[model samples]
Target: MKMKSRFDRNFDIINYTLLGILLFIVMYPLYFVIIASISDPNMVNAGKTLLWPRGITFEGYAKILEYKEIMVGYKNSIIYTFVGTIINLVVLIPASFALSRKELVGRKLFSALCLIAMYFSGGVVPLYLLIKNLGMFDTIWALVLPGAFSIYNMIICRSFFVGNVSEDLYESVKIDGGGYMRFFFSIVLPLSKAIIAVMCLYHALGHWNGYLSVLYYMRDPDKYNLQLILKNLTESISTKTLASEGMSTDYLADMQKLNEMVKFSTILIAALPMIILYPFVQKYFVTGVMIGSVKG
Candidate 1:
């Protein structure tokens, strides 16, 4: 074993100190949000809910639960995200794998078209018109179908296939009298777990957080996803809390605290799924992204 010199020891100390500081800087906001969500909003606003929660309460969660639309929105969002991610994976994985093959006819042309579409698109007006013509406007299909697969993600998955999957394997499968379909289903997918995990995470996050499509195409309130619903609910809560006149000062103060608490709670609600999801796929994330990005 090599013994570290004084310079090496000093360097190690400095490096760990910097890393600890950086970790604190990155993590503090999330911690604060968590503490603030459960703490008395008055204490939070008064700058006293820094390291730990004070006057912890579940009232903010209770307030959110009182609204029935929030539950409906949660269900809708879950359905959209689940269905949309499945569509994305089904389209993206096969397309990416096909594109990674050199033997595919019109590969260059297809790749060129994808790149063009990724960089340029007919603006919102044309898309809206197309959706209307297809009779998909204000429909569930409107939320999940239009942007089912992302070209950029496809490129990444394709790169991953090219980099990680050996061409010799395909040749061996062909030698065994197995065709492309057999090779793809039985071989490619099982071996491409890292890239698949990465793509799933990416697409799931996109669908979960997405609201612009809902905002543009959805008109029926019941069909609204969680993001839009939460946004509107927050606004409605804020308006009712502040705009009501002739309420007692004590009542107003309580409403104000509830308003602040509601804000933090809603944020946590919106973000909780993604936060829970990331840890499960984290082991694959770095490997997939780095290898896919560096190769092809």
Candidate 2:
């Protein structure tokens, strides 16, 4: 390679320096949280645990795991994420494939309608009543079925189907006497792995972290997802610990430590799944999102 000019060299140095600084700014808080979860809360509260863990401990995790409801929440979150993603894929693929076809009747009109729904929606009250009328309220269906289709995700799938898939493939299927159903299942579905993986990751992550739905429709604590359970625990910790009737002098310091730890630990616990899941889907995610952006 030819040697770069001084200007180019300086620009590269400046760009890298800026990017490195930005990366540190973004990553430090996450790093701090990870360390804080395992560190003694007294050190964290006193600002002594900033650069590295001052005192290591797992009291926070231990306390969090003591709740049986947390386990139930984990079970519910997993069920919701897996089942919900399956429904998302099953519903999205057919709709997207149909929409991707240029020869399909009312294609433009339907696409226009989908775009409109993205920009507009009825109020929360109307949505609640609709779910209630549909007999999905307080059930698992309420969590998964209401948000089964996302307009933005559907559009991405449609974009992939239209732009990435070759028209000649569909023509070949038709020439071979394959109908729409056979063509989609055999050709489009199999070839659309990247987009499907992208959709699955997005939908599954959203479902796993979902708490608002549980707060709104779910009256039963048994149905609470992990996020909701952790949220409640984090919120309740301060009040419940401070207001306990029989707290003596000796326990006060320990309760204070536990309370501080609970704050960081709750966030770490809730976010842990997504952090773990991202690396596995990252390659597919990149390809899927890139192709999904191709406009037809």
Candidate 3:
């Protein structure tokens, strides 16, 4: 018994060591970015700032906030993320539940169609033309509608339904004279917290980081999402044309560093809300994804 206990202790030590290494590998890059964002741009550019910041400055954050465009972009992104996630959930959850129901009429055909869309898409030009024809160009709907349904998320949710929601529960509900809507809302949805959380995280991140779709659909700069605005700002900084726009030499010099810092900082800021919230949601994702991936 004493030998077996020693073996278990050794195993635990090895396991913890491996876990610590993995954690460091994942965390170091993010830490490096944070430190670099606060350090002098020249230090960062010269690759001197890695583990710790040098010439620490909040000017980078200040410059990014001073831009009206960046502010507007933040507002637009928030609007898009909120509205888009709601639309996604509204469409995805019901669609997934419907798809999971074998008795639903034409279920197989609909599932096949959705799956086909995952592998093949109408080319970008065609999609752009369609959006233009639909008169959604330069509109917030242009960003929101095109991505309201993600087939991958739908499948994950459907799989969760198949695995976690036993048919016996549905049958029992039906025996009590419950219809699909009644059972779905009161029973299935309530029991699907984990999968729903996973879907929310997936959809929220997609909408938050999404910009190329907006770039294609939105022509007006006023309508630019956060990512697009940041892209433009980074471009302006890199090309050094920002100085030509009447910024003082001090501001310009600082702007150069500010630009570099903002580049990394905004990414950190943009991702921070979700990252902070993820731990709460992450507990659900593993179980959710696992259950969702299972066969009925």
Candidate 4:
């Protein structure tokens, strides 16, 4: 390749400088949280810790880990995210694939129904009553089943199938003595990894971040997901700080600082899974989003 002119190099330098600043702006809050979680809560509360950790200590994390509900909450959250995402795909992918087929009878009608339902929902009270009547209340099914197949994801998957998957290949599969099942399992699905990854990320993030559904349907603390448990724990910080047994000024100040520090610790713990998961599927995620959005 020919070497760039001086103007091109100058423009490239300016672009990279702006991008670096933008990257830091987006990432600094996360970096601060990681450092703050391990730093002395008192120093954080005093605004003495900036750009670096101050009076580093692991006390906040140790306390959080020792809490009995923390592990249980983690277990439940993991189960919900994994199992829920699987079921969501099982329902969503097939429906989308079927709707994507121009040869299918009544496809348009079904697609219209999906679009209509996507735009409307029954009120929350009715939904709650239905869940209770079905005996899914306080159960894993309650969390996983309701809203399992999102019409939005279904539409994206259908678009991927229509725009990316070749109609001629599908017809050729039929000529080779294959049916819908064979084509889906052997051909279409194998070619649809990008969309699948995007759907999985969406559904997993929904389940992982879910707390309102748990609060509404499940009254038992033992059944609570991680988000709900951590939300409760974080809310209790004020109460605990105020209820500190010591009357000394130093003791009260320390309690306040510790509570603030623990907030960052809890957030870090809750977000760590998605942060780890994103990198593996990021390429497919970008491809799927672009194809599903900008393509037919």
Q: How many residue pairs in model 1 have overlapping backbones?
A: 0
Model 2: which ten-residue window has the lowest total lDDT? 287-296
Report how far off residue 10 is in candidate 2 (Å).
2.8
Error of 2 at 211 (Å): 1.7
Q: lDDT by residue for model 3 over 1-296, one digit each (tens)?
A: 34568888899999999999999999998898888878888989998887789888877777767889877888899899999999999999999999989898999899899989999999899989998999999887888897788998888888778777999999999999999999999999999987787788788888888889988888889889888987876687678754456778787776566667788887776667778887887877677667665744
Could you give candidate 2's per-residue lDDT for residues 112-187 as a string of tens digits?
9988888988978998999889988778999988788888888888878877679888799899999998888998
Clashes of each: 0, 0, 1, 0
Candidate 1: tens digits of C-alpha lDDT, residues 1-296 = 99999999999999999999999999999999999999988889899999999999989889988878888889999998899999999999999999999889999999999999999999999999999899997788998888987898888888888877898999999999999999999999999887887888888788889899999999999989999998897888878986877999999887887789889888888889878877887876777669666854
The C-alpha RMSD in Å for every predicted model, in order, reads 2.0, 2.1, 3.4, 2.4
Pairs in steric clash, model 2: none
Q: Where is model 3 more than 4 Å wrong at Cα? A: 2-22, 42-48, 241-255
Tens-digit lDDT track for model 4 on 35-122?
8898887778777777899998888888778878988999999998889999999999998999999989999899899989888889
TM-scores for candidates 1 onward, in order: 0.92, 0.91, 0.85, 0.91
Off by over 4 Å in 1: 1-3
| Residue pairs with clashing backbones, model 1 | none
Candidate order (lDDT): 1, 4, 2, 3
**After best superposition, candidate 4 residue 235: deviation in angstroms?**
1.1
Error of 2 at 49 (Å): 1.3
- Sequence-dependent TM-score of model 3: 0.85
Which should have the higher TM-score, number 3 or number 4? 4
CA error at residue 269 for candidate 4, angstroms? 1.1
